[model samples]
Target: MKIIAYLDAGRIALGVVTSPTHFIAVADVAPDLPTDLIEILEREDGMDRLREATAGRTGDRLLADVTLKPFLHRPNAMWALALNFKSHIAETGLQTNPDFPHLFLRTEASYVGAGEPIFAPPYSVARAFDYEGELGVIIGKPGRDIPVERALEHVAGYTCLNEGSVREYQMHNRQFGLGKNFEASGSYGPWLMTPDEFGDPARHSVLTRINGVVRQRAPLDDMLIDVAHTVSYLSRGYRLRPGDLIAMGTPGALKPQPDDLEGQDLSRQFGPFPTPGLVHMRAGDVVEIEIDGLGVLRNSVITDPAFEGDL
Candidate 1:
């Protein structure tokens, strides 16, 4: 079943997307069910209940009529993988670390809903504001030290994610906190699809586009570390809880640099020097990230009004 979170008469509610343009509000079908998407998923028989509630019922309203919200407004944790794709590693000129996957955390505030505007900080036009399209895995059942083979069983569904980045801030330190956590810098979804409908996550394809031009495209299987391994690795330290989100890594550069400058010297040129092929977002550009079965996540780029020029 496909589930969507949206603003119904200015109030947040969950619904089941019956078609491309129609969805039935869960409350209308099952008033007793929780209104929040995360809470519903936390229930033991949440999926079954949703299916039963919307059974034989057509959508109540047109999708365009309601304002869509992020699938999970307050997911417990938002973990992102870095350098999982070999092509991405090559473009960034980073060496492969066979030992483990590089992981980072993004706060809830950093994400906006599909159709929402992606914030471009004051210097965004001058600095690097890049986009990374990735498939997001949502956890339903909580688990710790989960086995790789059994990891898929813990998954509830999947969605699309735009892992937007402020390249300049990211280079300030080894940590990606400030760069990735900029308010409204990234986006989550239009809705969520259950595992049964989505099928094998690896069989899908990811495509990212700026305006009308395609910038990034790659198969889900290109990742050096697959979804199962990522879940198992993360579960080793922390308990994977319901409503947790995992952003599978993105592929090679959507826009790559012309020159192949390696070593520490290249790193120093980030802020002062111009990065070839890295087109930082402007005030009116639209960015779209689409996954095979999952719907397209679209967002327009807008400069942060509060940003008063560069510091």
Candidate 2:
């Protein structure tokens, strides 16, 4: 089941997508079904419930006509991995503990929904604004100390994620820090695809493009730490809850044409970016992250009104 959370006539509703451009309201199918996605997941038979509710039905409404929001109004505990992709680690020349996943937390306020504009940091701040395209794992079943073999049992679905970064602030300290927490810099969604439908995560590729040009492409298997273990690892410390999101770290950026520094400093206290001449996202840029089974998660980059040159 492919689920979407959207706004219709000033009220929030849930829908099941039949195609990239269309969906059927869950309420229209079953008025008594839960309207909240997490509530559905909280039930042990969530997926089964969704299947039975929308059985033999195709979307009658066009998705383009409504407003899409991240399925969660207020996000659940959001965690992300760093240097977890082999290509990313290889390009950055960064090392990590081979046994444990490199983990970090992100605030819910940092994200905007699919099709919404993502704000870039102002020029006065620093110009090294970048994009990290990765996969998102949404937890369905809650658990603690989850074993590796049973890790996937907690997964509800998957979504596309654009983990935007302000490189300058990100490297200012030894941590991801403020650079990652920038409001409206990141994005999630298009829709959540259930596990039974998405099949094997390892078989798909994350393809990212900026203004029609491919900038990042890597197989899901490229991750140094895979999804199941990542879930299992996080469970050792915090209880994984329904709607909790985990972003599998991104792959290395592909060097852009000419590979020439555009005069913006890529240097950090540690070293320069993996792809030094790689172009960074700016206002007016359209970013797209596409995974075959999961629909495209696209956003336009814009400058915050307060940060505009008029100031």
Candidate 3:
């Protein structure tokens, strides 16, 4: 079933999107979306109840009339992939790293809902905030040393994610988490579609656009490491709980850069040759990431004073 979090009245309400005219009240059947959602994903017979709850509801409440928040406001941890896309490596002029998957972590502090404005923190600290459109896998059950063949079984559903980044901080800091997990930076949601509705994750098309231009496009099949191995490998020594987010990875795209009459730094030139460009978003730009069946997540970029302490 297609589940979405929306603004009902003034408070955030979670509901299922059945059509433009109908929205099943999640509260009427289930307590809350984030907390109660785990039960729905794990229960063998819960899908029917979910369908029954949202079946006949109607009007503005049905469509995404309100804003969408992070599916899991407090995900235990955020796991992300870097350079898993071969095209991303070619565009960035970086050699593919062999051996193990390229992984990184973004904390819950970065969580922001769709339609929410992403905070462009203090200029000095993060001059280049970039975007990485990725397909996020939500693990439904707890498993250890899972086999790749059974990986899809543990999956609860799928959603679209924009893995925003701050180039300067990520590269300069000893650990990238500080720059990667800034408050209100990571925006994703609209809804989480169960595997049955999602079909084959690998067949789905993931596209990212800025303003109205398509910047990146790739299929889930392009991923060097598929979902199952990723989950099982990561869980080798750690426990992957119900709400953990596995961000597959992003493809190649053109990004913003410092200009100097095209003669400043030869290393910084963007000449059709693929090199990672900092796709910085200004205060008014709208960024959209769409995954075929899952749904679309759009957010406006905004500037805000730097926030101190942890978000």
In lDDT terms, which candidate is top? Answer: 2
Better by lDDT, candidate 2 or 1: 2
Question: Runs in model 3 with CA error above 4 Å?
Answer: 9-12, 30-35, 39-48, 55-60, 254-278, 305-311
For residues 1-311, could you state the per-residue lDDT of candidate 1 as single tens digits? 88888887888999899988898988888999988878877899977898998988889789898888887868789999988887787777777675676899999988999999998887533366778899999998989999999999989999999998887888778887698888888997877889999999889999988776676889999988888888999999999988999999888744443442321233433442343334456679999999988899999998876685643
Residue-wise C-alpha lDDT for candidate 3, range 59-131, written one tens digit per residue: 3353635666666645566899888887787766765565567888988778677788877766655566777
- Model 3: clashing residue pairs? 21-59, 24-54, 91-274, 91-275, 92-275
Q: How far is 25's C-alpha from truth in model 2 (Å)? A: 0.6
Instruction: Report every candidate's CA lDDT.
Output: 0.83, 0.85, 0.72
RMSD of 1: 4.1
Model 2 TM-score, all chains together: 0.93
TM-score of each: 0.91, 0.93, 0.84
Candidate topping TM-score: 2
For candidate 1, the per-residue lDDT at 288 reads 90
Stretches of model 1 off by over 4 angstroms after superposition:
124-126, 254-277, 308-311
Residue pairs that clash (backbone atoms under 3 angstroms), model 2: none
Clashing pairs in 1: none
Per-residue CA lDDT of model 2 for 1-311, tens digit only, reads 88999997888799999876788999898787788888888888876878888878878999999989888655568888999888889878889987898998888878888999999877787677788899999998999999999999999899999988888888888998998889888999988999988987999999898888788889999988899999999899989999999989999877655633442334521225636435688899999999887879999999866678831
